[model samples]
Target: MTPRRGGAAGGRASRVRRAVILGVSVVLAAGALTASPASAYLPGPVDDPLRTAGVALAADAAADTGIAFGACPKDSGLAAPVQCGKVKVPVDYADPGGRRIDLLVSRLRATGPASGRQGALVFNPGGPGAPGLWFPAVGLKSAGPVTRKVWGTAARTYDLIGFDARGVGHSAPISCVRPENYIHAPSPDPRTANAAAQTRERAKARGIADGCGRRSASMLGHMTSADMARDLDVIRAALHETRLNYYGVSYGTYLGAVYATLFPRHVRRMVLDSVVNPDPQGVWYGANLSQDVAFEGRWADWRAWAARYDSVYGLGSTASRVQASFDLAMRKLAKKPAGGTVGPGELHAAAENAAYYDQRWVTFAHQLSRYLHGDDKPLVAAEAPDRSGAKAAENGDAVYLAVQCTDAAWPRDWGTWDRDNSRLALRHPFETWPNAWMNLPCATWPARAGEPVDVGAWSAELPPVLLTQSERDAATPYEGALELHRRLQGSRLVTEVGRGSHGLVSIWNACLVSRVDRYLTSGDVGDADARCAGHPVPVPSGTLGAKDANTGRYY
Candidate 1:
């Protein structure tokens, strides 16, 4: 999950944008594909599951009633020439005629010639709730060099498609609380909460769950990734594509995997980055626990980086000393929150970004230094709870819980959670408690949990898939990628050795980028798996800019 926090100011946004543009420009310069007819790579056959469900293939009718692409919706944040459209799909594929929801989709049409056009390349930016309508623009706007190259290559031969999954973004969005009431009330620091405080935290989690049931119960049950995968088929037929070319990051990898399992023949080329664990047993509860351990390691990496620049940051000269400094700062914040708004929880939330991307290490170190020196503004600005985007954040959080909490059965007994999380927290204190609380709502999720798709069931039937991961990715650890690779019989795995970043394709790693570019452009997966050296640890260069600092909560 992409941890939610306030973003950096002007410096970060400009820097992120510049990085994106530079990466995209390089990608556009890569070699192009030889001309080929679009029909050359049509899907072979429909799986029995889809064929049996009469409504499943009903979307094929969309071929006759194509999407009406027009001016992009103002709220979509898309610029001119990029068209927006909608496709109506059943809220429940099991009962296609029951209720329907509109899926908001955007398209950046292929820029290359008609004969060279491959088809639509669908994208999912992985929140399980992150709005993806802005994804197509990400290639031209903000991703890293290699990611941009892959996008650049696709843009030349494919019409890139981005959409808000059902019950998210502009597609009949669901929210558990109203913006004005969705305040981030301070809670006791998770790292130090006692039994009574733990009980109170559970109550808070239960309250959130109850609120979701009360406010958006109608849509909660339908938010599973399985249903979302079905929605993708509807989108495929609507676009008149015989096969889907997909790129999924984070939670999106799971969605793509489900789609491939359900409709194996309908997939042409697929790229899954930062893969989610495909083990049915680890559906989500176990996955989050695993993340706790991984995040701590990444956090340690950040502290070590800070120690390397102790003269610049004045935190400490050794990783242990940096940890001590961080502990001292936390104690001070516990006594009195910076700016009276950023308490321990908020500060942790802001600093946790360091675990997700090394790009934020310098900025976070600076924020910590400033806070310790009595200038709390940077720390405050990094995590002060903003109410303006509360509705959007609430919607994303609701959907995240709606999907993850219901995707698989979570331990109903609060004691199981308390025991497991407490045990893990003892060894990995960085994000254990915070993550446990973030997912605590699952203990009493209102909807009945659905069984995760048997991801490996149709693995042998799938075409070669390309998988990428940074060895130390915090969100979806490297082990998940290995597990997924083993499950997907013929898939290729590209490991970014020693890196800890969450998403690989969006970073400026040339080695991984070239591999992805080659696969997407020529459908080559070589004879075996591949490895790429990770980009070196970023050195503090006079406090370079950050990325999407103000983007609301994501998972």
Candidate 2:
């Protein structure tokens, strides 16, 4: 799904690319997991695939999309969802009267003081490609308490909107290759040159992207931040709101920015989590560097923890020394691909748990230790998506690339990538080439490049915006947040210093909650340097509580 970039002004963390969330749903055909033709335009509905409640479509332009005010099942939990009906938007907004596609919209009425209702605080988990539909229903652990209040306990207070983008989720799938080709195939070998691995990866990417272009013609082109902004308008019309109040994380930040830029008056309040810097090359470069650096820092944390158990695990004391050991394993794998087929590329892909999700820290540490000592069994098992979806998530990786590539122009010449990557791998070889290979589809994505939005960070006319970012973060990187704050003359940045993660909202930070709640409720993010909790002492292995296991009492 690599889209030939039209060339966005912002790079990885800038443009409305997908947020750094967990897997795309496997709800397509058997074992075919996917996200968007490009991305679940606004990913609120991808994860929350609760069987939709068959409700009548909005009668007119300003009909109600809210269901909590209507009726819902009494029970809560797995069965407890506001449930929604489909509202169709133009497949291509350019030709509104032509073809149509469904945007799965849902809202859990406000649970706060009804007398003091704050309109709708729409939730977008930033995927331009992520399916955020489950934000309200299942709460994928990142929607934060602000969202919980909306769909809290049940549909007591707020109205949440979680829709799969035009080509994502139950709306309509875009898939090129089946998961078997990627998943069932051998894991990567890390030691050798990454370029050869990238070639195979490109083949898999094209299978998905070209398949999407072939399957959905016009829909493929409509998969951009610009058009999705139009979809927001349609969402507004259906919601019957004069303005849209939004909460976006990761790429969701960009989505909110786009919506605000396109329809400033339509925004009542917007909270962009994990702020993206609008500088195209610099941001992606920063994002790449940031991931390498942050992961390295976290790698140290993993090493120190391993040190505490030095007697249990043979890895050395310092993070640097432990990394040396892991590097040795990668070299060995490069020379002799494991599992009879898996290579360095697949091995790194399998080990990507370190890139996101703190839950995997212990497992990865233990697995890496064993793999270094010649036990490849648990490593393969460690790489599976949590729950296999109804079917394979279709075209997710493909759609991810398609939208990204088409959304902006990436360097085409393999030479450029060769040189750039050689440099990146030199400094941050841990996840460097593997991460580069993950995004290789961008090199030859099928779609025509679209234009990147040159967005302003601040504006006098806009309502107060809250920008939350985790300092020392991977992926989106916190430095970009400062740039966004600097650019957005009126924007205030609340930092989660040293958290070492992306999309700093959720995961429990009192400072972030205070800043965001103030802004959302009272329409203000104070003009001070607001700081959230920095990184805490690294949690030890076997100390992972219920939350890490996804068995929280709340869940």
Candidate 3:
């Protein structure tokens, strides 16, 4: 996703770009797995016996007139032995003749026996800014177990496809600031009474907004979700598929929902995990407020779990005491950042991940315990930004803001932001301020906002869509999943009872795994939504008092 930039705005542009991308990266980086390199290509139109007899098609379309699949560039880091290519799509679909942007696409052929080839399944890791080129590898490795059980083979039953969404990795990314400006700036501390620090945070937000406007003005207005949905259609056409089979998480779920609304007939077996609420009123801003409250609840849950394992973690024997210990650690880090870099804010970014995924709970507790014991090394390492001179040619951070800030009109009035955040902080303290400041750039963003797509309903006949969500998910709360199911007539919702993990299907929790697998493989779900028990809460690996895992009970 590398794009060469003119050297005119070198010094200031670099600084601004780094700061903007880093801020967006920290918050949006949840749920997505670490990236790995792979090569892949777009499927060409030429008819072959294998295509007609083997791969399943959701619908019939004209012969593919798409770019020929070709070898990936040498430095592509795509070592997975797949095909890769670039598809040129209109930068703004409204003005198709205006300009074009190249989207980097990749595909992994179905590795199952020829008799079992299902079709192409598109995978999105959900950041809106997250680069999905590594998804094929993620599916091959992490999802191998689940796919193996469902299809009777390990590689994959369908052609696993991944791409860098527009303005993301490998796409024509939007750049606002330099990578160096991604330092630990002070965010508004809900507990902080310091007016001066609050002013600085506001200034920081303003600077990022202005920097992006000045540096990436041309790319800003064109990065909305509507445009991204249009791009998906182009990819579908190029792949010669009449319909799309998708698995989207977090922000990706929003993208998936929008796609289904815009092109209902073009869907086949869509799976939306950690579903986003598609209510027009909450297109981008209100969801963050929902996240704040949800994260706080998950934080409370983590504390209680830690108290239950007091013999191993020694944080406390009760939830309140465990929370106090965490507060003490944050205070210590605030006085002096651990390792001179990991401050209270950085620690929040690192530890907050636990609120979204249960698997992170044990590891985060261990790190917090060690931090209390004077080893902030792990905390610092978890969020250290890339200082390496090799910055991304098209930073995902820039695009995240571009799409979100432009997706729907964000409140332009700073006073509105201040009042709303202040009010929300009283009840939702854990993430309210940090999350507010993270998105505050939208208040003064340079992009021209687009009309938000109406995703509430679709009149066309659509495939049976499967929606999944953990009951306590902080990122995309469970209510959003129910809302999406309601919007999409006949869609089935699967709830992970008492769980908070973000990405559900291909992970642990056999109950969730079985439901999603069945939906994808057979396209058959109950006439309504189903609820499944969560994976058992985990304790420190060697805890002697560990009860029967399925019970998830401390005794």
Error of 2 at 174 (Å): 1.6
Q: 383-485, model 1: which lDDT tens digit per residue?
A: 7888777878888888999899888999999889878988888889888888888898988888889887788676777899999999888899888999989
Per-residue lDDT of 97 in model 3: 32
lDDT scores for all predictions? 0.78, 0.56, 0.69
| Deviating ranges (above 4 Å) for candidate 2 | 1-78, 138-157, 179-182, 190-195, 198-208, 280-313, 328-347, 370-380, 384-392, 535-538, 541-555
Judged by TM-score relative to the true structure, which candidate is superior, 1 or 3? 1
Cα displacement (Å) at residue 517, model 1: 0.7
Q: Which pairs clash (backbone N, Cα, C closer than 3 Å) in model 1?
A: 1-555, 7-549, 12-546
- lDDT at 91, model 2: 52
State which candidate, 1 or 3, has the greater lDDT.
Answer: 1
Ranking by TM-score: 1, 3, 2
TM-score of 1: 0.87
Stretches of candidate 1 off by over 4 Å are: 1-57, 139-150, 185-187, 542-555
Evaluate model 2: give its lDDT. Answer: 0.56
Cα TM-score of candidate 2 = 0.76
Candidates 2 and 3, the one with greater TM-score = 3
